[model samples]
Target: MAQLLKMENITKKFGEVTALNKISIELEAGEILSLCGENGSGKSTLMKVLCGIYPYGTYSGDIYFSNEKLTANHIKDTEDKGIAIIHQELALVKTMSVLENMFLGNEITQSVITDDNEMYLRCQTLLKQVQLDVDPHTIVGELGLGQQQLVEIAKALSKQVRLLILDEPTASLTEKETGILLNLIKDLKAHNIACIYISHKLNEVKAISDKICVIRDGEHIGTRRAEGMSEDDIITMMVGREITSLYPHEPHEIKGEVLRAENITAWHPVNTHIKRVDNASFSLHQGEILGIAGLVGSGRTELAQCLFGSYQGKSAGNIFMHGNPVKIKNCAQAIENKIVMVPEDRKKHGIIPIMGVGKNITLASLRQYCFSKQVINEPLEETIIHQSIAKLKVKTSSPELAIGRLSGGNQQKAILAKCLLLEPQVLILDEPTRGIDVGAKYEIYKLINQLAQEGMAIIVISSELPEVLGISDRVLVMHQGKIKADLINNNLTQEQVMEAALKE
Candidate 1:
């Protein structure tokens, strides 16, 4: 195999913070190299440097392509050299047709006129190569997320990409879609195109990667052949610690029902005739961790939102706390009733990015520090802010710093702290640990256990089956807007969850 790409002695710095430190990596032709790291560990930074997003002078690095020194001043400079990157956020124009999006910037030209026929032919070929069976003229917006992902790959193929860099490609995809994308990558490998696969899901990495490279805190730890390394080995290298156990499960006494939802139904916001959640009924007991496991669009998030009165659509449900009915017409009402939710999309719904960490933490429960004349008690607010930061182990220079400056894990912890400030009886965490590192996930698991020990009824909705099985006292499997099964978590496996999810 020929050497395709090599990044030597790469070091990237932002102000006083060093994002990457003497990091070195190499890729071989037709090989899939999986880059594994915690959030903010310089994996994305290193890729940005390679793809010219960081540019030459911004970072100190030497990039080589086929043993030739390469200098890319712009993204187009790298793209012209057969290197293409697909970020975690899709960069396609949704309103445009697939054919148009495929050849958006690098359009095919026939003597100064846009070559529509030639571009369409090439786009069809690219789509076929990616195994996307949709018509080239189909609008990108009408396509599902999985189909849109394939369109992104086909667009890369249109550029004759030799080295494909995929960052968290399957993060928003379903199991079936993920399988298709992985198989497409394998097919690309068969054609001798190298790939750099970055993802938090270790099982996909182990299955698809030829070699696994682990980096921690901006430095390359080591690389190993995927055949010999287990997921635990990769975790140890990434976090610089041996994690014998990922889940810290603690036994707690289950008491009477703390919260209950009966005959819950939610209608779609725009399409009033459609039901997103249908007649769902469940109960959460004191000192219990109830995990909701489902595939994408299984109505898990909708159910939680309806219960918390945060759903945008119309909802009808009977919510009971301590055997007394509560009317939660909105999120404010829900908060007043001591029911809070840490939403799944934390970046958009959980935090105020521009605000200080203290403000974000205290945003929900500001009434606690309000004085007589609609004034905030500054000294008391500061005390509560400091206490929450310390209690949640939020890593920040100060509580006054912008919440967005923190890592994903710390941001999530801060959000958890914000929800806890209200002293809620029912804590609903939706995809609580998504996009966080393994070490951060262990911490969150421990925190959930601690909360359970403290008699907080926790409802955890997650897409990761292992996480649900690992943390939950009971697992509720949902499918197609309905609760399929409620099973006790006693030696339960992922297979059982999937079986329940797939049941008719």
Candidate 2:
């Protein structure tokens, strides 16, 4: 029960903005401390300061590890001291094998020769510790997101880490995968390996942490024993306000059918014989929010991609707008027909990372701001960009800031703004609230309801059944590339949806 790590008076700044303000934290051996906050809050910043990603002198903080003053100038320095960080985005090289990624920088060597056999044996042992039953020779890219996550942990174990830092580890994982990860952390705890767990999933935090720390903006709110803190208490401390409802539902009239699909089928891009989406058909009505519920690999996302014309695979379907059949061969054609989607993987497909927030928001509808000879009206474009930022409530210091620098929640909102610029008749959102905190999720749900109220035909695909039940007027349960049931959301329960999805 000795103190393993302590960070005191941590303060970091970017030019003029103070990212962390006199924050302090302490963790003991075998303890799990959950860091809770909204997007852009100082949780990650504080961790970065601790792990030496921000470097020693760049931030004013005193770190004590093993009751000794620790001033680490690089991430390597911390890694050498038994501290390892696994970011939300996995840092594995996809083209490489699992063993290669595990021993990427620090390979076992003997007499100026790389010791592959020694490393392979160690890799197998680490994988066994994490319960990831994959071959060491398997390509990291070929593994599922859940398994890849476990690989990251196994890699950390190979580093001989004593204090581990995990950032949004379950953001992209399935429910079963998340369960496995939670259990693995408990196992690690039993072995006296301390951990700092950062996630927006309050239920997981409540279930896992020994202590909970809340940070707001750049300052420390407080840290308390996890035993007595409810998710509501954590929310109040993090957002500095009371959130009465997690899902804000407003009554809105559902109008006539605006779009319909018939015999929609999609084939896997690489394995052409496999059907990613099979003969899925549904109708979307104006001012109605439709929710698609399914587990991972159930083909919900493939169906949305097929509708948006962004599916990489071969697809066949009849898409009708206002009862008239239309052809959407590509994303451009889909956009031209006034149907747009905010994709599931925001970091990959949603926004241009290197581009400014303004440019990314206007990228989808730049034609509207162009004049003769494709010359853009800078004044008009800037005006609309500012307006979109305001409308979406995107928290950026300036629109010219790179969209990549924004937090996950703000990045998501910016992407939503970008899609809205197209002024689509039908909007499809896939996993819209993934990796974002509860407060930001509430804002997103409110916006979705508002859009539905404004007579837009909306489709929402989500892994969380509670989210599907909370906002949708109707729910479509898909299992094994088929839409099993379509039911009106009249006081529907999660059990009902799961039963439908699992029905034979």
Q: Pick the TM-score winner.
A: 2
Residue-wise C-alpha lDDT for candidate 1, range 351-420, written one tens digit per residue: 9998999999999888889996499998999999999999998888899899988878999999999999
**How much lDDT does candidate 2 score?**
0.94
> Can you tell me which runs of candidate 1 are displaced by over 4 Å?
none
Prediction 1 global C-alpha lDDT: 0.92
In model 2, the worst 10-residue window by lDDT is: 365-374
Backbone clash count, each prediction separately: 0, 0
Query: What Cα-based lDDT does every candidate model obtain?
Result: 0.92, 0.94
Q: Which stretches of candidate 2 lie over 4 Å from their true place?
A: none
| TM-scores, all models, native as reference | 0.96, 0.98
